[model samples]
Target chain A: MSYFSLEYIAMITGFLLIVLGIWAILTYKNLLKIVIGFSLFDTGINIIIVSIAYVKNSTAPIIDSAVSLKDAVNKIADPVPQALVLTSIVIGLGVTALMLAYVLKLYQDKKTLDIESFTDLKW
Target chain B: MLYTISTLILSLIVLVLAVIAIIHKNITVAIIAMGTVGLFTSVIFLLLAAPDVAMTEAAIGSGLTTVIFFYVLNKIKNHDA
Candidate 1:
């Protein structure tokens, strides 16, 4: 496959974002930064899902004047991944919101955002 | 040909923004950079023939998520004062 192909480009970007997110999550001491890492990881996963559904030389899955019904089978990209990513995006949003709320509560309780300071649960 | 080039450049920009968001010390700047990454990812989704996904990402990922982060940050700041 060509290096500049759409799927490859997006997939590589997605994977790199995932790695960056993981690194941030592991190394960042701040609670907010950890949330940012989770956000990046979520975005990367969504990108990968969309890229996997990509079809070479094909338009979107939409059925309009651009794509007739008869030969639409081969002319459009996969719709399944698009649908899946849609749901994933909503779920990610919910997860991010929940994480932030928890972070807020943690900050209120400890008066600090540092992960190292929170050791009540540490064994 | 042009589409491929655009996708290449956009993806590179997104990666750069992602790194910025990761390494930045300020919570506000990191959050904004992450939002920009989402915006660019939405555009990339458009190029990938997924306009619906693109719109959703732009709205929720870039717009709503950033706003939510800022809201929490502001609340924390008020508590500090």
Candidate 2:
């Protein structure tokens, strides 16, 4: 199989990001670093979803006067994933904001950012 | 094909940036690398023909998140200092 087939490349990249993200989350002691890793994982999943919607050489989903509806079916990329990704991206931002706020609160109370130090609430 | 080669190169760059973002010593540097990853991922999304997703990713991932992270970082620095 060709190494750079679009689908294969995208899937591999997305999977690699997921692995790196998991590595960061597992290895890092800092809460902020874990958040960064979570964001990486989110971006990776978004990339994979968008990649699935892609058709090599396909045009954007915008309806145009240049292409008739009859032939447009084969020309445009999928809209569903794009729409879902829109909401997902906004949700990711919100979640990150909440996590950072939590970090702020935790730091205020505990004077530290280490995840290991938070074990008092874990059990 | 040129398209295949470009995709390969872009994905490689993206993966490298992600690793850097994870492993970097400074939190600020790591967050900057994360923003770069987001920007590159949006470009990849555009190349994949998902322009809408590309825009959203750009705005939320690269733009908003980076700003928010830095804002919180500054706040924490001020608090501790």
Q: Model 2: what TM-score?
A: 0.95
Candidate 1 lDDT over residue span B14-36, tens digit each: 99999999898787999999999
Candidate 2 structure quality by residue, lDDT tens digits, A1-123 = 665687578778998999899999999999999999999999889888888888767888988796678988889888888899888999999999999999999988888889889877676
TM-score of chain B, candidate 2?
A: 0.94
- lDDT comparing candidate 1 with the true structure: 0.95
Residue A102 Cα positional deviation in candidate 2, in Å, after optimal superposition:
0.6
- Pick the DockQ winner: 1
Q: How accurately is candidate 2 docked according to DockQ?
A: 0.82
- Candidate 1 lDDT over A11-100, as tens digits, reads 999999999999999999999999999999999999999999999988999888999999999899999999999999999999999999
Give chain B TM-scores in order: 0.97, 0.94
Which segments of candidate 2 are over 4 A away from where they belong? A1-3
lDDT against the true structure, per candidate, is 0.95, 0.88
